[model samples]
Target chain A: MQSENSSVNTEAKKIQTSKVPPSEGFREAFLLHLADTTLILTQRNGAWCGHGPILEQDIAITNITLDLIGQSRNFYQYAAKLINESSLAPSPVEKAGDEATEDSLAYLRTEREFKNLLLVEQENGDWAQTIVRQFLFSVYQYFLFEQLQNSKDDQLAAIAAKSLKEVTYHVSWSADWVIRLGDGTDESNERMQKAIAALWPYTGEMFMQADYEQGIISEIHLLKDRWIEKVKTVFEEATLAIPENIFMQSGGKNGVHTEKLGHILAEMQYLQRTNLGAKW
Target chain B: MQNINTDFKTNPINNKASQVPPEERFREAVFSLLEQVPDPEVPVLSILDLGIVRDVKVIDDKVEIIITPTYSGCPAMDAISMDIRFKLIEYGYKNIKITQVLTPVWTTDWMTENGKKKLLEYGIAPPKRSTNNEDEMPKCPQCKSANTKLLSQFGSTACKALYQCNDCKEPFDYFKCH
Candidate 1:
């Protein structure tokens, strides 16, 4: 792994010297939204790596984390290229002497510049909360990836097509847990209900359109009802009640985030920040 | 039909000539050489057996191999790609290129019949064909019993499921078909 990190030094330098003008469009923001959301959530999910309720469950969650992070790597790599080819942002486009490698884009960005969802940034409180958060996000991702798989953009379509299968498994696995714990003992049911109430407010932002999503508005709107229907089915099967008429939290898509995101970045980026350009 | 026969009779050697184009012959040679490269995870199965090798092209004496990973985070892909390059180099093929494609996402259904047989023989149950019931339990490769229960949705790797046979009381891995 150390050798692998060092091996990219040459390519990284080449990327820096090739000063391609940033591509102009909403695509860079859209790609960052996908990449940041997954990357931030991956760090949060990594908190559960060795602390799962059981060995198998721990392994399962860790695998989920790996999958999410891998997906983020793909998005970040694509986003970095788009950022290089265009002049779109205050982020990933670095100051003098600094190049925006995927690692730099991920580790060096400030919290104010990140465009992830608040729901993913919120702390993983408990196993129930974690499961609930995963379920809600996976439901949205399922719908999003379904449409993305057929995207006119070939690279996005290819990435989505590969990621869709893995995310499908994530949806099923998390939904199964939701159903089991929701219908289990009274204590477990109570916890699941609480997690749902706390997390439901953040889910609304998933459907709320960001400026970058303007191009995909109608495409996203087409899948909104299906996402709702899918979540509704799982909640019903889980014997959990849904909260209605509640306010939904927003603004994470616009670079505003919960305070939790800063702490997550502090911890996840600590090594990279402290040891700048250090391999492995 | 008469025209076709007459054409063949006029240049009878043409059947042998056109049947194997130079490109096709080179492709066959590349495939045969690639067969020596086994999957990083399941060393018994070749990349062809794992269905990751999507295409093998030889153009102007240069070789290009196309591959797809089983999963997005599959750790074996990098190793497998490196192994392919190394083996090709060892086989004296210069100017080798390995391209990774994600479109038309890979499925376990692409695993060859011989691959499945090898997996079962190696004590790993191959993924079953797509069925409406996702909960369908795979037969235990150890005891050939259908009364196996899933121990974990995830196993040693992302692409496998852990199962334990009730009768034989043995744990095994099932290569989950995506």
Candidate 2:
């Protein structure tokens, strides 16, 4: 069997030379964006794995977290492949510094390196809050993935196509929960609205297009504006009002994240970092 | 359809090939047979159509089929695995393994064109490419109408969405492009 270091090196070499289209870098970034958001939220939902308010919901939340984790892994793997194609060329100074491997990059990245939306990193306020948060995020993801399926980049188009199917279900599930909770009981409705109201400020971050997004749209023909329209439609159907507050929180795409991201990275990277090539 | 057993003669396990172990052939046959098993959620589609079947390996005289679930918490995974095992066992392969691969996640782009057609025929709009260019909007399966509204993000199954066809005014399921 090959040693772990050798395996890592081999994998790194594979990533460095992989074939990814130049236009697909934005898709890669988008995948990383989704992965980071899902990873953080999955960690947060995991906190409620055994301690949900009800049995059915307990299973539901855990199930959603697991789904996000699965999706994150795939997106990350794809991101690694994309990065290899884009940034993995051998160094001019062969002796000085080499490009990082996908695994190494994933394992060694610091809190500031992650690019997930702030809505995901917020504390799971309560059952109502969690449901509303999921509903909102799923709506946005569903729209984004829907548009991404038509991406010019084949690999990203393919990934978006596949993930869109799963996200559709996720959005549906979350929407149903939102409706049930929002319209259920007097107390439940109030709590659900409170959750929605509290999280509304963060929703704008998802729609804020940055320079990278602009490049993706102008050059690659990827649609960021269309996604916003789709998300707005879903919100209307869910009987939720779109907050007119244009003052939206931002800074995940550019690598600025909430304070909670640091703690999440510490926990997620603990086993791989501490062990340093340790394998079961 | 005929029961799988009566379709193929039960060749003596040792009679096929002495050089290449029968287990290897059995594994291949199991995979080939499994390639026919349509995804239960989308009956017109096969698991291979979605590219969820990652690797099929023969180890210790057992056929192990690796699948990546479409969604991490998809409830259908258990059913799909069980169905794979049942279908293979029915074909006279008793020892089978179904492994779930969580890495390199499954994508809808893997769905075969044939599978996409089937999805459309089954009343669920197929996914377009991820680019969201206006040219790629999937027409409604039932009405063949491009005038469709995305009803909900989630669908009856974990991999679909609810869409309403403006032309036909019918609410139908759309197999999300993932």
Candidate 3:
């Protein structure tokens, strides 16, 4: 009787361990993805701080960048919390047991760990190109956040709800500029078309959901596909044609980004890396 | 009894009309004086008019003013904070504390009815509540027309957007709902 009870107890333990769900790790990865995109884009937009095409536009773009930075901070903070709770290990391990705080997680991560899409890191080309890039990105972001507001995760839903309002304005602003440049004069329209053609390749990366996103969708019931449909509808209304070129480029999700990201990181991490433990 | 009478008689009303405690009067004065501080973005509107000032408190001979920024990242927030400090100092309040409250997030819904009326009169559309339902349309500030179209979501400031009135053919700025 004692031997049989011991065997049964061992079997129960095995089943209990096996029954535990696999670590979704979705929330952590999603937060990092959002943070990387916002942080990099904020840095790019910050370059236009003093040198906008016009005074009003300069102020507008800078203001938008500030909003992005604020959003990035909030998202990164939430991501840090998620990371602390998740069982997933950090990639390209360097320092073991070095707990990452929100600030450290944002500032300390190496280049390969970032998961931003390549488009956000692309060079700002010219003023027209920048507007087009922003327009395209904002439209997608607005739609994405709109759907994300209903996410089962309360924190993510709250962030999405707040950011959706801001993204709506951002999209509208970019859309206006797109239409103005697209429908304006021969030179303006030509430039607008050129910008669109240049940025067309990067659009595919925004919609590509990988295993991390898929896991989250299955576990948390997140609405990732809905965001894509909403984006498509907006694109249709904007009188813009979706690029049919099936040859898509994607690497940012895997932390393989363009060369520009290296330089961006150098600038962003200089102070933090050089002066470790320094407080402003 | 003699001491209590002395205290009551020492009240400003008994000694001189202007010698009252000045707590209530000072608060009223500060309210009016601060009303002159215009919103950095929309100069035509006062900070009080926009409802950014949340509370005014006086305790232990110190003045505490609470304010909320229109947007979290608004550059105007720093300017507004500085402006409040300077204005209070200028008003002879030696110990003034300006506290910023970030929760409850500032929304255009805080704007006074008169403030909204003024915004429309100034050709700027007042903000409308954001709705998840799909049937709502933003009205134009100039013509009060529902036929207006959103020209762009981004406006001159983080808090506004550019919209065009189809009826009047005028382009106006819409104060965005936070």
Candidate 4:
């Protein structure tokens, strides 16, 4: 781990000291969107480390957390590389430098700078809420990554190809739970429905295009129907129905976020902020 | 071994190759070395068995080892890299370089047959899949029964799933298929 090339340490470096291509701004933002979403959700799930309802399930969610963390790191490493190579911000060009290590990028960024979806940063209210959240998010990720696997960008394609298999498991696991609890007991079914109502409004942002995603993810509009189809299938099996005409709140991808993100950032950044440049 | 030169990874027998290229021969030696570098998480297996080490190359004075991660957030990767470095250093090789790549992603199919056998002997069921996808349950590592039930989709580590043998009634880890 002490090797200079250790994945953990290589990302931490001196400040911006080189020239960057202008075209990479959108790409960098795209990468952060992926990384921040996974990292934040992982932070939420990590809170379940010792508190899972059952031992096996606790391990399952924790493992899911670990897997998402790995995925997030891959995205952050690529984003950091892009940032290091090029400021990626045409205007500010102030940060995302050689010093924008994955650690710094994840820990030092403020809520306004985070580009994750509001759905992921939502409170893990209960086990059912988490399950609903995972199901909705995983279905979207599975479809998105499917398209991304063939991305023209080699690194992005590589990441998509690699992580899609894991995402498939996430989709299956979450969907299975959605079905199990949605069709299970009277109380369980009621909880699943409530979770869906509360969370569905946030999911539309997934299909909506952010400025940075325009050229890169040109086909975002098409993914929505497919996402709906999959959700409908799972909901049907779970004996649930689609809600109609709900307003879709947007802005997480645009760097505006729910206040929930602030509390998450505060808790997550506490250790790193309390002691600057600390490493284990 | 420390008295010997590790920077020089070429086998003495392959110094003047009559058949294979010196680079190919050098890679074989490196692969053999990596075999000795056990996976930090699964001590029963090496990096090669885990299919994380993608390729080995020699550039100028340095030996470059390319690896891919098995899971998105596999904590073992850092420790595995450290182990490889220590193993190389122990062999007296100084100009070593390790790079991580993610393409043609790794799968359990890459596990050497010997490695799978080692896993079974380690009280953990090796990765398994039934033909036609009839069942996903793994055969019991202890009793070799196909009558195992899944206890958890996740086990102690990210790469495995927990299963209990219905017959033997022993809860064991399955080196799950990716």
Candidate 5:
């Protein structure tokens, strides 16, 4: 049930007139993965816009927030197009209609419909926690975008290529903070350790391939290895210990998220839900 | 928009309609025309100077121009594409198409030396050539002093950084290297 990477080899053809098409399902899932991850992470980062430790840092985090939202908007637009064009069965949390749009997809969807990684949706704890979360996610995303730049889907590839540059900066910025905080004062080091313990389990969910991504599961694993290597270097420099063989949290990709996600969705969707279709 | 400017339209340099010499000549004309399209945010640099114009193709009377965006969230790209279209239309070109490509991905390396100079002259420091040199401090555009410190990683926009000169004590924007 592998969906063909149409941009790569057009010669390979398959005929499956029966059963729900894998391509349709995979596309819906994958696009949601893109949109939800970016949207949630944007919201998380946006929380620090005016509240960063310093004036410059506030503006820096806000810029990253805007970039994440911009990337999510593109993904949501593409997802809406896919859903609109196909007769794919809607998930329980999704409502397909003629009014499908990026805004509707983002603001109208229920909590259970989102497919973001759990790491992003968790509460932006302390400054140390936030940086730790950002560092881990940005490193994974940098590798993800690099691989996705060669996607058979030209539009996705374009989006990936454009976003890769932004995420590269995010990784570097967050990694620097990680080193500073991890190897800094005793209090900073303790907080960094606690942040790592809280966030490490969520990292596992990022590598778990969805049904649509089954074809590229091995590729993702390779990227996961690269992510690990990159993180290993940062940890070595920061004097932080890498967690191993622990029980990893799961289910965010399947629209099942922790309590933090529900609260986030409430705040994010409130304006849109209350003032339906209000335009700025 | 300005009375069609018939004289400007007929001028070979302005209109680019001097009987097509070759396909290459037509492309050259289009490139020269696009050189007039400046970035909306950084007006000192033309889209061509910024290395955003990827390619220009002429098929019979139809023209296709390809451009790439510097950032995923760059709002200026919409304005830039519109500016290209209007500028070409003002020159009397018909059936013009603008396509955006993102394959090779944009880097500050694509920005022309001239563009970098313009950025500096405009009081904003240009990005360094290398992406990995994030730790290296950029010299102040106003003072030309490397004693500047980064006040913020983000600036007025996503592409620049906020910095202040230690020598001249002047605050400025540094166009971050992507």
Candidate 6:
């Protein structure tokens, strides 16, 4: 019989070793979590490229999407290289001929194969909703990158250091928008509050430790405190309050995602799946 | 490709002979040749001027030029690699390889002084001192005014911020200090 799905550490490790070495699986999955989260969020943000409310704001969000895409590519490239090198099982690695590329990782994986957080896959409901989602995630990411800059892995550390600069801007821009919309017209304020209520449940999964990320990205609860403090100040300035004791969702790190993820993959992976390695 | 150049067997790498290793000579020649490959986005700046080229090594007559991406998803990198490959091949180097490294990330601070000057002359304000100060607006490249207001932190490109000169009433891109 298979082990309980709720426990991702041991079962996931056991299941993974049939294909890869335990150490390699851990490192590869850790890279996937980072890469997939940004790649999904960028997909969400990138939908605003031509359709944003205003030209300037449209360009601004598009630019941010570009930066996140860059970050995602870096992580995916590293992950691909890792997978290419470490797959002990030749039969499975040879399924794709032992060539795992950034494109394959992004465009080929099934919903359960993706390790992105549920926070990013939530619908971009309205302008206020999107901004709130970005505000919450960017605040968390800013601190995460700060801690990641000191990672024992040189490649991860370098990527984090480079990404911290970009995330700094994302945090500020989203924070400003949160405040602007929260204190704006009554309709805007109502929508902002509603978005926060809808999105807050997904925020808790970010701090939950996945088995693969144990040593690679540790001290999740410490980052949570700092993340809360920063968000609290911003929310207070925006005349909003940090909500209390909500039921938090988890399992994204274990690749158990929401129904939204399936739809996202359907749309995003269409071109790649249909054509298979079609290049411009 | 030029009259000034000698054959690879004849030591075209600046007259330095067996005293310098063949790989080092190939590296030197490649570095100078790369100086001629302009960044596709900012044509005034070369890959060398932009500081993306990290290291050059030659292994068994294969020239490898190592570079770091300025941004993770920078579109220019593909073109730069292509340009580099074309330049190397044109220069009679048959086996050339381009490698991208990411341990030490690229930063605007790595850009050369001459690159900065060229950027200013090309009508985009060069990156200011390597400080991530949002309050400090760069001087206008057009009017040379200190009074500038940041319109948007995100500009036409990932490495630029949109700003407007208060005096000149003209908007310009400020090369971001990333």
Candidates, DockQ: 0.29, 0.16, 0.18, 0.46, 0.37, 0.44
In model 6, which runs have C-alpha deviations exceeding 4 angstroms? A1-24, A88-98, B1-26, B132-134
Residue-level lDDT tens digits of model 3 in B57-106:
76545667788667646677667877876786676666666776544456
Residue range B39-148, candidate 2, lDDT tens digits:
87777888888778888886555566888777755656777887887787676666666776544657677788887887777778888766567345557787798888
Off by more than 4 A, model 2: A1-28, A85-105, A215-240, B1-178
DockQ metric, candidate 1 = 0.29
Model 1 stretches with alpha carbons more than 4 Å out: A1-23, A87-93, A97-99, A219-221, B1-23, B131-135
Off by over 4 Å in 4: A1-24, A87-98, B1-24, B129-136
Cα-based TM-score, every candidate: 0.87, 0.58, 0.65, 0.88, 0.81, 0.87
Question: What's the ranking of the predictions by TM-score, best on top?
Answer: 4, 6, 1, 5, 3, 2
Interface RMSD of 3: 8.5
Q: Write the per-residue lDDT of candidate 1 for residues A1-280, one digit (tens) a residue.
A: 0123455564343211111222356777888889999998899889898899999999998888888988898888888877777654445437634656678889888898899999999879989999999999988898788777766677777888888888888998999999999999999999999999999899889888887776543345546677888889999999998899989999999998878888988988898889887795
lDDT tens string, model 3, A109-203? 88898998888988888888889778777876775676566566666766767676677667766776777666677888777777777877777
DockQ score, prediction 2: 0.16
Q: Give the whole-model CA lDDT for all candidates, comma-separated.
A: 0.81, 0.67, 0.71, 0.82, 0.81, 0.82
* Native contacts present in each candidate (fraction): 0.67, 0.31, 0.33, 0.88, 0.63, 0.69
Please give the distance, in angstroms, between residue A264's alpha carbon in candidate 2 and its true position after superposition.
1.9
TM-score, prediction 4:
0.88
Candidate 6 C-alpha lDDT tens digits along B81-176 = 889878877887766667787657787999999999999999899986776675677999988998999888788888888999999999999998
Candidate 2 C-alpha lDDT tens digits along A1-280? 1123544563233212113333435665666677778777888889997898765467656766766776676677667656656753432221225443434545666777677888998879988898878877877777666665555665666666656656665676777777777657888878877787788778877767755454333312123344456546655655656567547778876689878788877887798789865567
Query: What TM-score applies to chain A of candidate 4?
Result: 0.89
lDDT of 5 by residue, A256-277 (tens): 8999999999999999889987
Interface residue Cα RMSD of candidate 1 after superposition: 7.5
lDDT of 1 at A267: 89
Q: Which 10-residue window in model 3 chain A sums to the lowest lDDT?
A: A13-22
